[model samples]
Target: MDTDVISAAIDFGLQKLSFTEIKINQRKVVESFLAGKDVFFCSPTGSGKSLTFEIAPFVFKYLQKNDMCIVLVISPLTSLMRTQTQALNRKGIKAPNKSSLGDVKEGKIDIIFSSPESLIGHERKLLLDLAKKNFIKTVFVDEAHCIKKFGLPDKKKKKLAYRPCYGRLDEIRSLVGGHVPVVALTATATEETKAVIKKQLCMDNCSEIMVNPDKKNVTYWVHNLPSDDICTNFRWLVNLLRGYKQATSRMIIFFRQIKHMADVYEYLETSLKHDAYIDFKEGGPNDNRNRLFDMFHMKTDDDVKDFICTSYMNPNGNIRVVLCSTSFSMGLDVKGVDTVIHYGPANDVDDYVQESGRAGREPSQQCNAILLTYKRCLGSQNIFPSMKEYVKSKTCRRAFILNIFKTIVEHAHIPHFCCDICRLSCKCACSCEDECVCTNTCNQVLPKINTAIMSNEDNDDSDDNDDNDITELDDMFSSDSDSDVLESSTRKPQVIYSSDDEMF
Candidate 1:
């Protein structure tokens, strides 16, 4: 890979850009577009991570033959793929998917965008063969966090299944040659998640870069309320939207479940009695998917701005308030997101951070990320206690986030552990933090919960099952931790504080 030529192409692209002036952080990302080095990048949303990878194929084009260098971006959302493919086509680039696989095989496509599920079947083999012949040069995993197994398993099987890939990533990687440099990009990564990703991609020695997580243009706030009074909360949301509507600003509201999404949309359309447009994705004759593309995509005649729907819809609408699930939190970037409201609790701290990071991408906009939950149900079993601890904790949010990554880093280095990436010892120094802040804050806060939830018998059963599967899988595919420092670290002194005033 000629790094100098790649840099020159990036410079040329940025010089002729319009609309938003490219930020310095984005320029730094473009500079790191080198070949033969797997890169793990964590940047805030709207910081131009997509642009960095968008220009990457140009680098390979400089080094390889014309149309010989193909770029494949694996995104989690089909809607996102469609939007990106449309945008790329407008730029006169050939980007196609299974719907147009014929065009791709006819040598009509320079870029191919697909979701993990669509990349698993017979069509993938043909692409894999072409890729091995050097037709596909670079692979980019957008919304890399989905590889960590988002609630897909839970929702699909109605239970939490821990099988990370569901046989997707492993299958896809096997098709592509090992030498093909892979790039994993996300807006949020806990130390644990980073470790998992590195191990999964076999990129232990990969260079890592992160843009500042704390955005000065965005404000963060948390509200505790009663779960039963959800309607009252919806009223507050309406008022919030009204306040922003007066300013003619755009906003997004994230929900936890599809049922809740439907309920909120119904309330807004009926009780609020607003002419605001609503779209739900329950598959049926009247399903939103039937008309979603025509309604949301700018190419359509729909002028609906107050888009009320689940995370499944294409988010191209000039909608003032987009009600969705956490699925909208990753990869897809929208500018002028003035506010992000969480109607329910998040699954974990990592989730909370990713969702909140969506607001205030524009440097001059005053955006706010508000976390609202019921006060009485704060200690509910369904709600992850770690989130409550984060909201109520006194430590710097950045320190807390870094600490999560540090633990995962240490876990990655331990030998004989069958992680997603390798089978042997991992030798990578994850210098992510100035100090380990988790030892004091998160260690002691959950002993009772851990003990109550985790039993010796449960451990034995789970361990036995995991060992049997690990041994079998490791043997089949050839893929696939310390006490003293742990105990002393747990004994450190700590401080705790409470929110004195209610945010709402």
Candidate 2:
């Protein structure tokens, strides 16, 4: 590594990002990029993965003897582009996202961020025109794993993939005319996924800088449920919040689909008002929200769930929760988010790892990654081997995830608490240095959601009951029929639902 590149990392850290020092891995990435290598980089969240792009302009100016350096960033998410653009500009670095190529020629903007579609769209000619003039020094593809999952959506499930432009990213190299180095970076990608990115981005001569994707302070927990429905599996999550009293911890609940995300986001807001709580001892739903809130010393006057439903970049201590989708995974840098809840099966395994990696970013903040879903994740026919094992295997969840990117460590990596499996088996007992380790009895420290409740969820209709549920059904089924016919039909499905049917 060049001494100049090493000095650049320190200079940018101390003067720009306000850090005492940069990591060795971070320094190496900078060195490789500045050497004009098409770099394939992968590291976990909170590892300062963005440092390479942040200090690139400084390194370019230092190398080329130029006053201004232009770096174009091709990111898949719009929210990520906006967040990075805002943060950079606020730091006196004039970076433009979703802006014209006019800014590039103006010679004031240092960094530019955009979605793949934008660069490949009508703006392609303008962007290529700028690249032709050597106005854009280097091109960056942040969250590069998308190049595999979204770019090449499987033929069977092509509709699930929204950004097909990721597959077409190879055109970017031709447009830039091979002068600029395209750096592909992401937090999660298996060796197979890496190969896909390399071919898609045309990084044939790319050097690699990969690191372990395991987050030490983060704990992983999976609750295999009976059903995949949002209302069914997410009950425990609701109860976890209902029973939670902590004001310091922040959370992000991720969903792959927008409808499910909206449904749960809306439910958390109105659940307290609708007596959504279940009391197995007392049997069925009841409104004990005020009692529980008072017990937890929770804030009642504030609209806690009135968090930014759309953009989830800013971390507010007052906002306890933010519901996220696949797009928000890359750019979410909220410092205090210590709890990450992933609902449903991830269409792509990389998205699951990336989304879960968002929590516990701050060194002092211990976080939890809770998986609430059924056995199967998306990618149904072609699931990542390790992801399938990690979900079902009763092994060290931390090690299982780490091996995805194959984190090379000097010795066995000791996590703060290995994971729920390791904790229960006392396998993590040796991992933690403290004199005492949590026994299997310590599950109380975590929430106990009755996932099997879907099997036991019963509607006790009294003989006097004449609610409007029958009307909600299609008219062809029961609009003309008497209430007795509807009752008979409802009972049949309830029997199947109540049975020991975990086939899903």
Clashing pairs in 2: 151-167
lDDT of each: 0.52, 0.60
- Kindly give the stretch of ten consecutive residues in candidate 1 with the minimal lDDT sum: 473-482
lDDT measured at residue 397 in model 1 versus the true structure, 0 to 100: 42
Instruction: List the pairs of residues colliding in candidate 1.
Output: 191-405, 199-421, 225-373, 225-374, 225-375, 305-319, 423-480
What TM-score does each of the candidates earn? 0.67, 0.73
How far in Å is the alpha carbon of 431 misplaced in model 2?
Answer: 17
Q: Where does model 1 exceed 4 Å of error?
A: 1-3, 11-33, 97-99, 151-168, 239-248, 274-318, 375-383, 394-504
In candidate 1 the C-alpha lDDT for residue 359 amounts to 75
The TM-score of predicted model 1 comes to 0.67
- Candidate 2 Cα lDDT to native: 0.60
For model 2 the local lDDT of residue 416 reads 32
- Model 1: residue 468 alpha-carbon error in angstroms: 36
